[model samples]
Target: MNYAYLSSLFRKQTGKSITAYKNELLIEQAIDIFKKSNKNITEVSNKLGFSNPYYFSRVFKRVTGVSPSVYLSQIYRN
Candidate 1:
């Protein structure tokens, strides 16, 4: 199948665009990293293959309703 057709099928099956799904997975990984490691946001973002920390923060906020720094603070507080 072509890229468009596969993307449409993926969206129909998963109810999210491919990029959205990928970002969600990345954010999930980020959460795990935050909980288990001492790495900061930039390191996590780079480890997850994000081009830049700013974009990573944007995606993290979009998926988690909080920025990476805020999420880290919350986790670390507990």
Candidate 2:
């Protein structure tokens, strides 16, 4: 239940650190919320606890290979 043990177990199973996994999960959830809601990037960023939309867009693109606006456009096109 401790931090070290949990991080070890998480890394063993996922081959990534807990922080990386959590950030990935956050991006995935952000994608879902963006696609399903009418909120703009700044609103979505705020809702997800990001201090600013620019930082959120950076993390989103880093994790998913697309900016939030681009991702939303792609989803809408398909």
Per-candidate TM vs. native? 0.96, 0.80
What lDDT tens digits, residue by residue, belong to model 2 across residues 6-71? Answer: 999989999999888877998888888877878889988888888899999998998998898898
Give lDDT tens digits, candidate 1, residues 1-78. Answer: 899999999999999999999899989898998888999989999999999999999999999999999988888788
Off by over 4 Å in 1: none
Q: Which candidate gets the maximum lDDT versus the true structure?
A: 1
Candidate 1, overall lDDT?
Answer: 0.93
Error of 1 at 17 (Å): 0.5
Determine the backbone clash count of candidate 1. Answer: 0
Which is the leading candidate under TM-score? 1
Q: Give the TM-score of candidate 1.
A: 0.96
